[model samples]
Target: MKTKLLIIHSSDELYGSDRILLQVVQALRDTYRITVWLPVDHQDGKHQLYRMLQERAVEVQHMDMPILRRALLTPKGLVRMARLAPQVARKLRSSGADQVYLMTSACLLLAPLARLAGRKKTTLHIQEPWGPREAMLLRQLAKFTQQRIAISQTVARSTGFAADQLSVVHNAVPRLDPANPPKPLELDADCARGPRYLVASRWVRHKGHGTLLKAWSMAGCPGTLYVLGSAPDSANRIDVRGMVAEFVSDTASVKIIGQVANPQDWFDSVDALVLPTDTVEGCGLVALEAFRHGKAAIVSDSGGPAEVVDNGVDGWIFTAGDVPELARIFDRCTASSLAAMGEAGLRKYEEKYTPERFDENMRAEMPGALLGS
Candidate 1:
């Protein structure tokens, strides 16, 4: 009989951390029975996470966990978690879970759950930057968790985990075949704009969409910008749309392409990937996605994206939030340079970031008996 594993994931959206968790679950579902507990389910219909996990037949559970939401920082939030911890611990003990895994930082609150169940062999995957406050919050579990998986060197150093306990597992995903890849969506090539650049991420304040817009305008409106990913559903969503519209006031130089099922399919149409992040991101999977698609990236020198991009080798890196530097990069990149850089990036992905590499990583981190028949 295979060992049963219980995973605590932070969000419902299929972002970088979520994608990595899906990859691990997909790989080990055959060797170990897997159950995933998500904080919430996608609104309206389904998010990409639900559909993808269903295809693999992995069991997903949705529960209202206060620690997973914004309320965790409030006074009432601490009271709620203090009251809820024991109940969650009971659920873990009753699940007959052979192993417990924490998939993201938000799931760190569940550290008490594994301990209360007397499961000492818990693994915590740190996907976010661990500063002093974050380290202090998770300090209690530093000695308890059996394994610590860091997505980058920056994260590994920040956590100060013992060398024996730490495993640096970079985020990875399945690559689309380059020969007969997803077809590009044909659009009007009216002499109305220059070459196109794409931004594929959740549209939030921290993503630096506004900075990209400022740089695009400052760069003399070099090319058409295609913004992909889910538009924010916040009260600011309309304001965000208005801001984007204001950026491209007269000409059709910018587009709020909204969300898409497979942004990679749309990638076949754009010039290069642009990620202008203001936060100290853990690992920008967007850079990997771009590389796998034989595309180069213009990433901010913030955190993990820099690790993915070899400065001026496969792509360019500008100081994060420096609109003028971003504008300068946009000014320099042409069709020929983008292709050469993309080919180099593609080589790096094939050499480092494939599914085989992901499987090897899991096998290395997990015990032999659990991952093997």
Candidate 2:
């Protein structure tokens, strides 16, 4: 019988992480039986990956758990996880999976179940650095797991995992289909008085939308700022909306078109992309998305954005949370300069982020390490 590998993830949301996981699964379907476990039915759960898996006849198991929003630290979540651990462990062992792959460090409780299954039958794919308590749990879990794959070098260092124990397998997604037709909404040359700027990110305080708006308004408010992503429905959303409404008084200069099915629809309308996040980021899918669209980016110099931007090569980087520095970049964004950077961005994306490259990487680094051993 072929070896079975179980993928344990907390959620099946339509986010970058989930998308990447789906790509990896699709690539590996010929070799192993891929079973995905999720804690809840995500909003808009009918994602591209979900549909693709169904077509491939892959198994997706959803376990009903009390996963409240922003309740990871609450006692209720901890208790529920404790109760679910044994049941999940028994099922994982009964399925006869050769290895249990835990996708997120947030699955501290689930790690123990994988560990109890056997020392050689577990592995972990960690994306972000964990807190002290979580880190301690990760260390304990790592001892039992056969291998640890870190998404980035920075994240690996921050997690305090043993240098030898962790291997960097940067996240990969399917390359944008160039043969696919561009969105119908074409850009009007007259619409852009200055260089067009695009940003696709969730509306949250730490995402630094306020700073981006402030910088734009301060830089004489030239160019159109196409802000994508839905304004969050949480309390923070109200504050973000108020701030954006106050700063973006001119509808022509700035527009907040909430979430689109495919952001590429508007990507062609922009000259460049920008991400001004203050807090630590995992990896900015928007930056990669911009690259896929052949658009240059100016991202904050922290978190995953910092790692992606080549600082004046394909794109530029600014100080995190520094509105003045962001404004300075805005001042330098001329149409000619942006066009040159866009060309560079496309070159870089083709060179490094292609689906072919990702398949080669996994075949070389992940097969025996993750699924075989």
Candidate 3:
């Protein structure tokens, strides 16, 4: 009989961390009786991640659980957390799961609760790189878990976990069909004008939307820059459209393609992907998606993307948050050059970042007891 596993995740959006959660379920579904528990539904009513899990035949549940967020760090929030702990403990006790998996760092608060609920074997997957203060607190909370999984080495270092307790598993996405790819969307800009670039991330301040806009304007808008994604319902949201209006004069040169269901469809339209993140990313999964689609990436020297892109080979890496350097790199790139780099990226993706490779790594790195061995 398969060992029952209960996975608890904070968000329901189909973004980087959310997609990685789906990938984790796919990798372990056959070996474990897995059920996912989400704190809430997507605010936009799309339920993209929820739908995807259902389509995969994975059991999913929605409940009001304690999720760690910026708002939940205040005095009143502490009281609320204190109140919710018993309810969460009850849910965990009744789950009938042999093991509990916390999908992201936001769910780290549940680690101790899971232990109190009599689930001794708990795994915490760290997908976000936390700041020093938060990391200190998380390090304390992490002691309750038996195993830790980090998406990248950068994230592992941030967790302050001992080497023996943690494993680094770089994230990967399923490769798309090159021959029968989704139809590229028709934008307002002319396709034959110059090279086409894309920036697809949540409209958050640290993702560097403002810096990308500033650099695009500084580079005289060399290419058609298509911006995808919208701000989440959070305090950290950025006014992406306002920034574009402030920096970009020739509006037609920058197209705003709002939230997308399948970013790979847009990946089929652009020559390269640009990720100008102001902060460290756990893993730049979008860059992997670009590589899977046989496209190059122009990323900042942030934590994860820098490790993924070879400086002058598969993609270009500029100094993080350096507008002038990014602008210079943008001005120098040509359609032909990006295409060559993209071909190299495809080769790297085939060699390292495939679903099969990720599954193998998961099996090798995860504890044998968790795998029911």
Best by lDDT: 3
> Ranking by lDDT, best first?
3, 1, 2
lDDT of 1 at 108: 73
Residue 41 deviation, candidate 2, in Å? 6.1
* 1 or 2, greater by lDDT: 1
Show model 3 residue runs off by greater than 4 Å: 41-43, 177-180, 186-189, 369-373
lDDT of candidates 1 onward, in order: 0.78, 0.72, 0.86
TM-score of each model, paired residue for residue: 0.90, 0.90, 0.93
For model 2, residues 99-155, the per-residue Cα lDDT tens digits are 677777655456566667653567677776565666675677566666777777767
Colliding pairs, model 2: none
lDDT digits (tens) for residues 181-254 of candidate 1:
78778765722476678988877778888788888888888878888877666643434567676764433677
**Shift in Å, residue 315, candidate 2:** 1.0
For model 3, residues 1-373, the per-residue Cα lDDT tens digits are 9989899988886777888888898788878899999877233466777888899889997877778888778999889888889999999999999999999988888999998999988998999987898988898888888888888888988887766668888999886867867787775356665889999988899999888898898988887999999888788999888898998867678888897867778998899999999989888988898898889999988888888999888889998899999999888889899999999999989888998888888777554654211
